[model samples]
Target: MTSASMISPGDILTRAEIRPILGGSAYGGICPAIEERNVILYSDHEVAKKFGYHDGWLSENDTLGPIFEYTGAGKSGHQSLTQSGNKAILQHVQSGRTLHVFTRVGKITGTDTKTHRYIGEFAIDEEQPFVPRQGLGEDDLIRTAIVFRLRPTGEFDRSDSDTISPAPSTSAEFVPLTITSDMLEAAAVTRNAFTSSSLRSRSNSASLDAAASGKIAPVQAVNVSEFQRAASAATTVRRRKALLIEAYVNQLEAQGHSVGSFQLQIEGRTTTLRTDFFDATDYTLYEAQGSSDRDAVRAAFSRLLDYRRYVRHDGLQYEPKTVALLPGRPDPDLEALLASYRISLIYQGEDGKFSSAF
Candidate 1:
């Protein structure tokens, strides 16, 4: 095995070949080759399935390109981000280290030695890196897992069959919901938007604002507005959705309806689900979307269906109404889709009043 820096993408090596070069236990999935300034990630999807887990899959190309979801270390219990390889994977960018991935291909005919296929280099997705997931542990119990979202930085073995499949439809005759006291605290937790990209744009905008107000030299504002504009454009979708939720909550409260959100922990799942807003007085559950476009409306509809199970809150004699809240009325086709599922639609009109369809 050559040094880590010299190892190119698609270079396969065995544990025996990697040990001397990487200086760590060759058996571990996350190996830090200290001398070479590289972090080698070994993903064995086949083995993961045998343990009742499915991860280390490649996703189709989207706007940001392909993403590989890799499960972090630890076979049982909840995995911590601040410990071991999880920390290394998180801070690899700041430490100036490269992430090289390898997937177990097969075992040598009869021996215990397994071969790996070098996939290529990857970087943690800056927007969202760690995703909480549920997987069975070694003890056959459900445990919390951390999935690291990795974006490819170079050419990888795309011919592998481990492509990420779309999530299965959530429609079922019976969906279980586990009530937890942490619902309010979890719902209040803000989504993280402080990425490096957002920070750079904020600094530039602050500098430009100071310059425009005569607090700094006018020349310092050169080309800063363009960067600031780009940053604002990047966050438009999230901001729009947030604003819609806030306005709807206020409207509900003004109408004598108690508005709140819930973070639900489904039975047997480590990941939790959060509702956009719930009308306690009227017994309505809402799933809001910023845009009424086809994709956005479809997503909101799907989520609303999944959340219907939560409408049967404790002490309630009947299930609450499921509603899809949109910034504006959806097209006739989309409205029909919601109606087919018996989901009510509520949209804000030009007059600032909400229009509803039951």
Candidate 2:
């Protein structure tokens, strides 16, 4: 990817492919914008401060990643999300827009000669999506911030694109350097010295230029307290979603339909795809999106598509109807959007009413 010195909230068209924009520039020559405005430039560096887990990236899995800590839509007491200054940033995620991501290379703070590695375009991880979590700002005020999970659009774009190659967390143990026969023979006489020397060399190279590598620096222990708080918040969201699924399942059962959760195991695949509800009578698979937000809805759509593909690949006896089940009615435009894709939407009402958009 061509490494532009800067990119902002609305710079790229949502339809343009990422490769052309970035020219496959993985890392290096690109620094976390040495500055940021509305569009978050996430270069693997943790902020210079020791306190808050304000801005950073967490690649939870190859497919699921999270960006922290932007305030969410003004639903809760998250004033930051509602501020006019951040409106463009919030819309990018809420509207299912992709953003450019770069990881830090050398120290990027307090200096003008910093650089970043372009990771690639990332869409917010749709499955768990964004969660409102407890976080303290630099000012120490209690606030709810939005943490968006992101997933790369294509393969890793940087030299260090191994995603977890060196392991991103500050807590990552010093991974020993791989030894070759040539180095082994020379170091045999002084193994301890060789090992320590090699480790230091690798660490130094990873830091990339001790002078420019800002103390804001690369990945931290992922903020222990923040990790715990995010985890707890996710658990709560899951529990609430489960209840909504149960309610929907009960409603279907009462209507004399036979429905059950379905799990599909594909040969040679370690992970099995699971569906929220499967109706045997109609061979319909329902995917549950606990929230009515855009990312969640879009993520549910992606999952349903994946399930449909995997089930077909599994050679099921019958084709299945894919429906997205939501806990509450989403935006009216979202319903129309779902219909446009030929995916049905069924949502629960505030009074526990259910309606379907087919």
Candidate 3:
């Protein structure tokens, strides 16, 4: 095996030359050369497609720069961080190992040699190292996968064919819930599915059984259209806030007032933050908190401060009044904090009426 110094960026090499020069397996997506003090990553778009994933590409330019998303090592089932290759990549900074990346270009004709184009070095993004995504595995079953965010350390190959489009914004329109028997039944089922510990235990047991029997467990496929509906059915704090907004919007409509929400898409960011509710009749922007805790109260205040800048009324000359919406009244200190900023507080009383405090 030759020394690691032979490999350089933009150099094309075959599988046989990699092991002798890099000191790692010449196969697999992740190759860790311990003696070489290098962690080599290979991004093969063709192989990824077989597993129902399209990875190993650069994203559209953002504030920081374009980031490369590389799928972690796992061909089937759930990809765990505990694996050796993933662990090595995760702790590369602390371990003092350099990361080298390569992408498959093509193979030589009439032979068994595969060609790879070295794409320079990279480091994991400190803000968000990796993201958990759901995709089909090699077995064609849904599984959780890990995608690592890598930032370039130096000049690297940038090609239009290797760049990916920006991800879709996460924005949802408000949905009014109707009080019907079937709707109640569906809600009850969803609540049990989320909160019941026994159900979770049974699910774990079923997974084990499937593994023992060499059978893959069935799971729902990813569908963008049903994302909001599935999110609303969860028993999370966000879900509770959605319900609160729905109730308040209904009340405003009953009083012959127009109400809706605002979707704000900030530049240089992929996510779109949506306000809880906006009263078009009176030009008031509402930010809802699921709980009256201090943290939730503080976050609601911060969001209101940010959202008010873009919120506008067509005919009004003044800015919209900012109000914090909660399920119940907060402590005196929290209320004082909101009042100091000149932000109003609105809570639902036990009798199901909205009470405002300023």
Candidate with best lDDT: 3
Tell me which residue pairs clash in candidate 3.
Answer: none
- The whole-model lDDT of each prediction reads 0.61, 0.44, 0.64
TM-score, one value per model: 0.55, 0.36, 0.51
Instruction: Please write out the lDDT profile of model 1 over residues 18-81, one tens digit for every residue.
Output: 6666555667889876676778888887667766566555444558877788887777765654
- Candidate number with the higher lDDT (1 or 3): 3
**Tens digits of lDDT, candidate 2, 65-153:** 33322223232333332243233332444333345665545643686444555555665443433333343555675443444444555
Better of 1 and 2 by TM-score: 1
Compose the digit string of candidate 3's lDDT tens values, residues 1-358.
4364576777888777776766568678888888878898888888888987666555455588868888887889877555678767866775667788888889999876788887878988754566555557999986656677788887787665566544454323321111111111122213222222322344423422232222222111112233334444323454445446656776888999877556554554443345656788877888887778898899999998888876766656566899999989999999999999879999988887889876
lDDT for predicted candidate 3 compared with the true structure: 0.64
The most accurate candidate by TM-score is 1
Superior by lDDT: candidate 2 or candidate 3: 3
Worst 10 residues of 3 by lDDT: 176-185
Off-target runs (Cα >4 Å) in candidate 2 are 1-232, 312-318
